[model samples]
Structures are given as structure tokens and as C-alpha cells.
Target: MAKTLDELLTVTAPVDLPSYDSRATTGFDGKKADAEKQLTQLGEELSNLQEKLFAGGRSGASPTRVLVVLQGMDTSGKGGIIRHVAGLVDPQGLAITSFKKPTPEELEHDFLWRVESRLPQPGEIGVFDRSHYEDVLIGRVRQLATPAEIERRYGAINDFEKAFTDSGGILVKCFLHITKDDQKERLAARLDDPTKHWKFNPGDLDERMLWDDYQRAYALALERCSTDHAPWHLVPSGRKWYRNWAVATLLLEQLRALDLSWPQADYDVEAEKTRLAGM
Candidate 1:
């Protein structure tokens, strides 16, 4: 029998990224149709959880928050995950950020500074489309920073994450795992359609050439940064349907673990109802 998602995922340290199957779909034994049905149900549950979580925080019922960090190579369906999973939540309760090449102002600050400023507020779900992991992944691959600087960043990232989690934040980092072949197909599909041409960047081909280096960088980052406070989940993204389902499942699992409750008003409800009824 195939393994469960928890077994298939890489949440613990000592991870061997190369050994992880990008094509993994070991848990669910369903076709696209079945996965879609499950995704619909999961979406409904997630919507409810998001509202309650948001309400709890907004009403001072809870201080808990959530942050989802998504990192992957180009054409890895990060956009799709946003539209499918995070899109299910109420806009008021959702916070989304897409990290890109740093600006002059951003470069002046510590790498994590910008990210820290955008964390989810209490009872909110914050999604980082491409998070600080870029510093280690692309920074290492493209030699944007010195080797010593890169090494220092690993420690800095761990400390930042520890502090964040200590503050009632549930951090879930997911690395969308897709094969080189999958990327090629995705890129090709985009090219074959004029509407998607906007998504294509010539520089992506340049980065594709350095795929091996990026892979190594990711492997090192995952191994070094995976901690009990916040762990990494290597989500197989070869199949779009399965990828969406797995990521959605992960989000639902984390939200359920919070055990959040609807906040109750302190005033007497019966008396308030009677008074309002008289008016």
C-alpha cells in the first residue's frame, strides 16, 4: 500500500531532497475527478475554519495566526495554489505577499525584515507566494551573496522562525516539488497559448540552466532550517490536482489542530433579546 501524506512529506530534518520523489502521489488513490470532489469539501471546511479563526482574533478571543510559506522552482503552480486553496478564505481574513527581487530600500535592511513586517495578524492566514527561502535558494544558486553571508542567513532564518512561532503563529512551509520535465511541459504550454505569454520571463530559461545548483541550495536550506517550531513539507507538484489536494489537506490539518472556538459576548443574551424585542 502507498504511504500517507505525512509519511510521503519531508517535515523532519535529515531530509534527502534528491531522494524525494517529485512525482509522489502515494496517499490518494483517486483520479482527477475524485480529487476535485475532495478538494471542494476541503474548501468548504477551510472556509469555515478561516472565518472562526479570524473572528476569534478580531474579537480578542484568540491570538493564534497562520502563515504559509510557499517556495518552488518556476512553473511550479504557486499561483494555482493561491487561486485554489487560499482563495477559499474570506478576503478580510487573508493576507498575501509575493516576495520578489529586493528593492534598494529592502536591500538596505536585513533580508527577513520585509517578510516580518507582512506576517499575518491575529486570526489571519498569511500566504507568502515566494518567501524568504529565496535568499538561500536563489542567493546561493546565483552567488548573489557571499558563502559566509549565506551560511549566516541560515542561522538568522532559524532564529526568526523560532521567534515567530513563539508568538502564537502556526508556520507551515511547503516546497512544491516538480520535475524538470514537468517544468518544461508547463513552460511549453504557456508558450503555446498567447494568454499565458505574460507569465513567461526570459530570465526563467537562464535559471532553468542552473537547476542543479538551485536543487542543491534547496536541499541544504531544507535540511538546515527544518525545525520543531516550523517544519517543511515537500509537496509533490507533478500532478496539479494532487498538488492542490495535498496542499489544501495540509492547511486544513494545521487549522484543525488549533482547536479554535467561536467567541461569546459577555452580556446576557436573553435580556438583550428581550430589550431589543420590546423596542
Candidate 2:
């Protein structure tokens, strides 16, 4: 049987990160090098499979839609992963959305209203940079909602995701796990590099002060919302390369499981040749 999201989350460390020095090698550590290599090979195979699945398919048999929701704190490598791993996917069938602070209209509506409007159509993949989970994660962490309100959203989110999955969409939620120390280092690097200075926002520094609160929020979100259909994976994100590989591997694995093939059709070569000759 396949592993449940809850089981995966339980097995994952709440706050552990791979050592930065260890990332200099191919694997996370020497112990997982072979496994990592295998995953990379699998990712490449999956990429090829995805390409084949999208080719020569028309109205009758549409490919399965994949929805990947990526959520994390400041300085998390969300943009990097999207640029690298998802960049490998066929651009024609993929959609990427990055959610920032709510606009006036969005703030007036329910949190999920905007998200629902952006769902992937058949044969397409939608990637959410920050998703509806924010209603529970950041909403709770920032005390934007009351305890009862936060609790209510937990069930609502689960049901919403269940509906998406039941309707033939595959949902994968990844929480990019990065350490505070690493985040500081990355943020500093961004400031030091002139080209990256534009990426820096002073607001991120404020969020860093509430690191523990965010962690607690994430733990609860993981504990409550991880379901069999849409599981959340905590990607150790200090190493941007490993993070990209892991995300690409998981996506490839999920997409490979989908039945994405063209329906059989009859063709008349002789009739076509005769018609062409007559013409």
C-alpha cells in the first residue's frame, strides 16, 4: 500500500535540516547517495513519460491534472524550486501562481475564493506558491483569527482538497523546511549580491523574529491537514539543489502513476491515399 500523508509527516522531523556542508556531495549524506541517485534517475524517466503523455492527445482522452501547493516561511526556496524542478515540465501544460498579500477584493472574500478560480484544467498542472493553507498557517500564527475560527478551517480545507482529488486532480502540498540560521545566511547573501538585492524585502526580517510561532503553526497544519489524497511533504530546503531534486522526483513519481495516454483510433491509409491521388 502507498504511504498516507499523515504517516509521511509523522516520520519526518519537525525541524531537522540536512547539514549545509553535507550537500557538497551528491546525496544528502553519504548514506542516502545511492537513493538520491536513483531518485534523480527516476525524475528523468518521469519527465520523459510526462512529455510522451502530453504528445498526440486531443479532445477524447485528456491527461490528468496535477496541483502542487508550495507553502513556507520567508527565505524558503519556493521560487528556486519552481524555476528549476517545475521548469523541466512542459510549459504549455503548466501554470504557476504566486500569492502575495491579499488585495482589497481578496480580503473581502473568503480565503479560498481566489484559489478556486485558479485550479488547473484537464491535462494541465497548477503550482501555487502560497495557497489556501495560509488561512490556517499564517492566520493562526499571526493571530489573525480566533482559535475557533482556525479550528473550523481545518476541516474545510480537508474537504476542499478531497473534492479536488475526487474530481481527478492530484494534489501535492510541499512545505519547504529551512532553518533560521540558514535563512539568515541566505538573506544576507541576497543583500550582498547586487542582482539579488531586488528579491530582498525588509518585511522578511520581521517574519524571522516570529520563527518559533510559524513552526508551531506549520506543525499543527501538517498534523491536521495531511490526508490520503493530498499529502504534505516537508522538503529539507537548505540545499537548493536537493530541494529541487526531491520536488522533481515526487512530481515525476505522481505523474508517472497517472494514466495519460491517447485513446485508440482507426485510420484508413488506402482511402486517404486514393482521396489525395484524386485531388
Candidate 3:
């Protein structure tokens, strides 16, 4: 049997992330039609919650922001999740960054330097398509950095994420766990459809060759960096629809936990009404 999202979290939430299945759809028993309906509803609720978070300054406190970091292999639906789930929110309250190869300047500084400037402001939700973890994942798999350097980066990542949360940022890290066979199918589908031909990269196959190495790197990254403040979660992503739904649900869970409310109006309602009536 598949596990519920909550159940999956309970089992995978440990700092040392246990092995997880990538295709479990345990909690959602509904059909596709039902899932779509529920997704629409979730979209609405997400919008409302975002509005409250956006207007947080009206209540005279700095707004609590959230940063959702997504990591996975190519063809893992990171783009799809951003378009489907994060797209539902008001863009004014959202900031997104997709990290690519580092520039000469970026290479000169520490790994986190390029990441610092892209952080979401107060009352905003930030999403990283691929994040600092790349320094460890690709950095390890490709030997861009030595084993000692990779280990040091793990420590740096943990400290950075912890400080982010301590400074009123809520961090949600998700590893879109997809199987090798599933990836091959998706890549083939991309090739099959002319519209998606632009999405296919010849370089992805190169990375695919080092799948086992990448997986080991990921396991180590998750285990070391999944801390109390910014824990990691594995979102089963073999199914595209389920991946979108699960990401949305996970975000909703975090937003709701903040118990955000509309900022109280500073002006007197009755006085404003009287003044407008007189005008």
C-alpha cells in the first residue's frame, strides 16, 4: 500500500533520511477528476494564504517568508511543479531562482555567495529550481570539488539554512524522487513530442550515466543537511499529477502552520465610513 503524505513524511522526516519509494500515491484515493477538483480548491486556499502573507507589514511586524528548494534529476518535473503549483500564487509575493553553471565571479567566492542575493523579501515566497545543493551533488559526482570540499559544503549548507530559518524564513526542501526507468520514459516522451524537443538536453544523458554516484551523493546530502529548522522531504514524483498535488499539499501544510491572518487595519473603520459618507 502507498503511504499518505503525512505518513510518508513521518517515515522520511528523520535527519538521516531512510530509503523512500518514488511512486507511492498512498493517501489520495480519488480519481483524476476528483484530484483536479481538489487541486483547484488548494489553489484557491494558497492564493488566500499568500495574500495574508503579502500584507503582513500592515500589522507592524516583519513578514515571515518561505523558501521552497526543489532538487531532482533532469526530467524530474521541477519545471512542471513550478508552473502548476507555484504558478497559482500571486507573482508579486513570489521570487524564483533557477541556478545554472556558476560564472567566473561566482566561482571566486564561496558557494553560498551567489545564493544570498536571490532570497525572497518579507511577505514573499521564494522557490529555487536547483539550489546550493548542486555544489555538493554535481560537485561530488563530477569531481568539481574534492571529497573534503564536498563535506565542508555540507556543513556550510546546514548553517546557512539554519540561519535562514532563525531569521524568520521557513525553509522547505524537497527531493523529487524519480526512478531511472521513469526518467528514461520521460526523456523519450520529450523526444517524441516536437513541442518538447526544446526541453531535451543531450547533456542530461551524461549525468544519467552517473546515476548511482548521484544517488549516493543525494543520500549523503539529505542525511547531513536535514536539520530541525530546515528538514528535507522526499516527494514521490513518478506520477506528474501526484508530484504537483503533493508539492501543493506540502506547501499548504507549511503555510497553514504559520496560522497567518490578514493584517489588522490601522485606520478606524467607522470613522472612514463616516468620512466617506460626508464626502
lDDT of 1 by residue, 1-279 (tens): 855465567556666666777777757788999999999999999999999999999998788999999999999989999999898789899999998899999999999989989999999999999998899989998888999999999999999999989988998888998888889999999999999999999999999999889888888998899887888889989999999999888888889888878999878999999999999
Error of 1 at 4 (Å): 6.4
Model 2 Cα lDDT, one tens digit per residue, 1-279: 865322443223343333322233222343455546765676567667666555523343654578888987877888987777777667886788998777899988877898898888776778999999888877987888899989999898999999999877888788887777878899999999999999999988888888888878887888788777877777767676667776776677677677456545556878888999998
Candidate 3 accuracy as TM-score: 0.91
lDDT preference between candidates 2 and 3, better one: 3
Winner by TM-score:
1
2 or 3, greater by TM-score: 3
Q: Clash number for model 3?
A: 1
Q: Clashes in model 3: which pairs?
A: 2-26
lDDT of each: 0.89, 0.74, 0.85
Off-target runs (Cα >4 Å) in candidate 3 are: 1-7, 10-19, 57-60, 267-279
Model 1 worst lDDT run, 10 consecutive residues: 2-11
Clashes within 3 Å, all models in order: 0, 0, 1
